[model samples]
Target: MTYHETVIIRAMNRSRFTVQQGQAVILAETADDRPLKEPLRDREGKIALSGLSLSELKQFMKSLGEPAFRADQIHSWIYAKWVKSFDEMTNLSADLRNKLNEVACLSALEIATLKVSRDGTRKYLFRLPDGKLVESVLMCFQDRDTLSACVSSQVGCAVGCTFCATGYLGFMRNLSAQEIVDQVLSIQRESGKRVANLVYMGQGEPLLNTEHVIDSIDTMIHSVGIGGRHITVSTSGIIPGIEQLRDENLPVTLALSLHAPDKQTREEVVPITRKYPIPELIKSLKQYVEKTKRRVTIEYVLLKDVTDSEEQARQLADLVRDLHCNINLIPYNPTFAEDGAALYDRPSRDAQVRFKRLAEGSGKTVTIRLERGTDIEAACGQLHNAYKE
Candidate 1:
């Protein structure tokens, strides 16, 4: 393997991961997780026949006394053909199929609730095996022929950005890598359209759950056939996660949730900034660009008087002047509440236009994000489990 490829393998952050409560157990998320001593099982204790990486599947097939090549057939059947059951893998022997039914299961998440925006944005709340709920969004753009899914890496967020909705919910736990990918699959299964793009700008800070986030990206590309370039992982500026991702050397995009331009202001907007300040975050992002050769995305949320002022606009422009990045200025979505009142307001249209112009003048591309599901509080920063049951 190439040096970077070796680094990619090393960066998976693999460790001992326990499985379901009942019978079998296994270790096989990353290549470094070692050859398994037991069968791979989901949280329900059945040997999990779903969501295995290509190499892990091969190891699994070898364990069953099946030829390694059976991994190809199973991978193709589950991911490419989107089969719901092993019995549907007609190529497998009937005995193997019966055995699979007895000891293994295809764990698909149950849809707890679905909400549709008039703008064609579909938001779904999914119930995990342990009954924890997470949210995913599907947006179909007629103009671009793009179907994008915003997926979560954790159940809720720990970043605690003062202006974010999910921050109010606090952190529960990180979603497993399969749980992340299943969100996209669930969108496709329900909408009957392939998701052309993925944005990891959902409930949790994706980079905080670095290993599974990268693993999920691996499955999305190698198994589910999504292009690496089509995926974007957004972060709340975790320096360690940024450094780890830089080593992985994937072609996916990186978006920094730089809601403010300066260190103090950024710490106020993106609380993680206190840990990884603007200068340090920028240095890490520069290293990321040098490695991946991918332009970083700077996601800035514009609050009415706080971040939309002329001075802040100038600072925002100057901040990204030397970087290979674009600016996406998002309007404040009223998800953060105080005593039943929305805590922030969207900046006036004039301020947004002026800020975009200022940033564009810095030779960095900038666009004001169009509002999507504000009516249902499903827009950016609005992905807390509001529809939780």
Candidate 2:
């Protein structure tokens, strides 16, 4: 069977499940059905309450025999005050706090590993409840006084980008909305600062896991109070997923991982392109722009010799010029070779400048992404694979 066929089969398996209790325990077997291990739930089978908005928290409190006004107090302590423990919520009565700690648990993901690059970028590896691992990265731009956290939506990538190390592990599973939101919170806790922006560009394709990703974005915006416009979701041309994102009418930025301009090149590098071609992907993106009236971002990773040529740059420029969008050129991060072949050769500074100039000449906004956390392998496509090796 082709790789595409295999991916479809896996997705089908994931979707055929019935949950037991409040937990996401899937029951598949007949007679003594076994509980499926949930990825983000704490040992006590609870997820962090941090992602719930005031309204959602009110609804939840009402369901649990508490007054809705208590939700406002909970929200303040969780998001505004950033209380680490339940006892630290001083405004909350000691009895109520004890009750909350008993019936409802505060879930948090443990930091399994952390690596800081000489460039000051921080990458954190978090261990989920099921023992599966996912990563979140913090890119700090001291000069600009900006910090952005790249969060993952899945443990391993299903998109199978040939150049990405995350794809090597294949598809493990989709992360819950809680898992996605926790990555952002965990990063903030580690840095002791609120992130200026959020990017869903780590580990997996954000679009492939649409429901959880959108729910996570909603929580980040409405609950966590992060501005929707400051958030970006990066996808490798998942057509249906893009259409769903547009229908949501959210102001979050949509970024397409348009690594290559041509069909053959794109198909070779991003296997999903074979299923959703550039023409179709462009149609979805245009619809997104028209619906949301927000500029889309086209993320192009420059691979040495393969796609860094002037011809490729011109094609990329032409491809995105018509769409109301910007181009973010990311230098390729080195990864372990499939056959011991070299792939780390990033484009020289001169070549990157030339490519940026060419793309901008097409009247589209273009920005070159600075490589972050390379020394500690915290740069893009550089995590998890080391653990595998």
Candidate 3:
């Protein structure tokens, strides 16, 4: 097996479990509730009850010798009421609350640090139970008064997109469905407003963790009261994940992080292109469009002189000419800069405008996105775990 898989297996041994015949076997919590084995303080312990579905929750309650309807009651308290602790669930009996405390916990993320941009964008650095850190961004679009949560799906990313800061961290492990959903909940609590949209564009590739991502979406739509239409899962062109998404019966928006237009350029910027070539990716995207009847959003990051040339823009326009999609032009956000080898630099205003005009000239809807939170590093491709040893 690959090193990444081995890392995931080791991490899962402490924090993750599988469902068997509608039952989930979670790690047993200790008497002091310090989590499972001392070495894995956050990884193994009581299951985060917020991560459980209603049926799964019922199974857990049955295991604890409780009635099934109690699962619905607990679900209402957790999702509908958005309670932070079991003490807030006054509807449940005192005895049951103590029992739940022994067997299950709510969330595992502890706010390690929080940074707010001048534009009111808040970046949360949450410390997971196992002491690993992940970043999530809460963007406030004041013009529309809309709040969007950009949550991570993994501790770090494996895609190794050359421009992204998260990619350098390498892949650690996938976040549990509850950990993903708790990001929005944490943002909602911090912002004191309802989150209008959810974007899985934070630290990891959403499609790579399809099962947990789909489960998180189901929890959001069914339990958290967020519409599936308002959710967007962005991927760095994982074709199999795209095909899997097509069959999942979800109508959420799919955003392709198509930073480069052609095979050679794309493979340079996005390494996944080597595995799933542009032609195969385009074919799968076309099938996804036909199956879902949803227009995909093409996310193009304009890197100075690299992907922002007028000719490259024209080529990009030609590549997606037949696809039912809109283009979102994002100015590249540089992670760092050295004397001669800057990681990435934003295209000039002229280049940005020219690319947008060329894309629109191709009869496709195009939008030059407002650059948000560069000062505090909350903008696209700027987010990463900044806590250093």
Model 3 steric clash total = 3
Q: Which candidate gets the maximum TM-score versus the true structure?
A: 1
**Clashes by residue pair, model 1:** none
lDDT of 1 by residue, 239-351 (tens): 99988888877778999988888777777777777778788888999999988788999999999887787888888888788899988999888865757888788888888
What TM-score would each prediction reach against the true structure?
Answer: 0.89, 0.86, 0.86
Q: Best by lDDT, which number?
A: 3
- Candidate 3 residue lDDT tens string, 1-389: 44235334333333333334433455465334445422112355666776556665675677677788998999887777778889888988999888777656777677888989888888999898878889998888878877888899999999999888898889999987778888877766656778779899999999999877877887687777788899999999998899888877586899999999988889999998999999888889999999889999999999997899888889889989999999999999878633536597788888899889987866899999897788988888877788754
| lDDT by residue for model 2 (237-268), tens | 99989988887766689999999998888998
lDDT of each: 0.79, 0.77, 0.80
Which prediction has more favorable TM-score, 2 or 3? 3
Point out the worst 10-residue segment of candidate 1 by lDDT: 15-24
Write out the backbone clash pairs for model 3.
Answer: 14-43, 15-43, 42-129
Runs in model 1 deviating more than 4 A are 1-4, 7-24, 27-43, 336-338
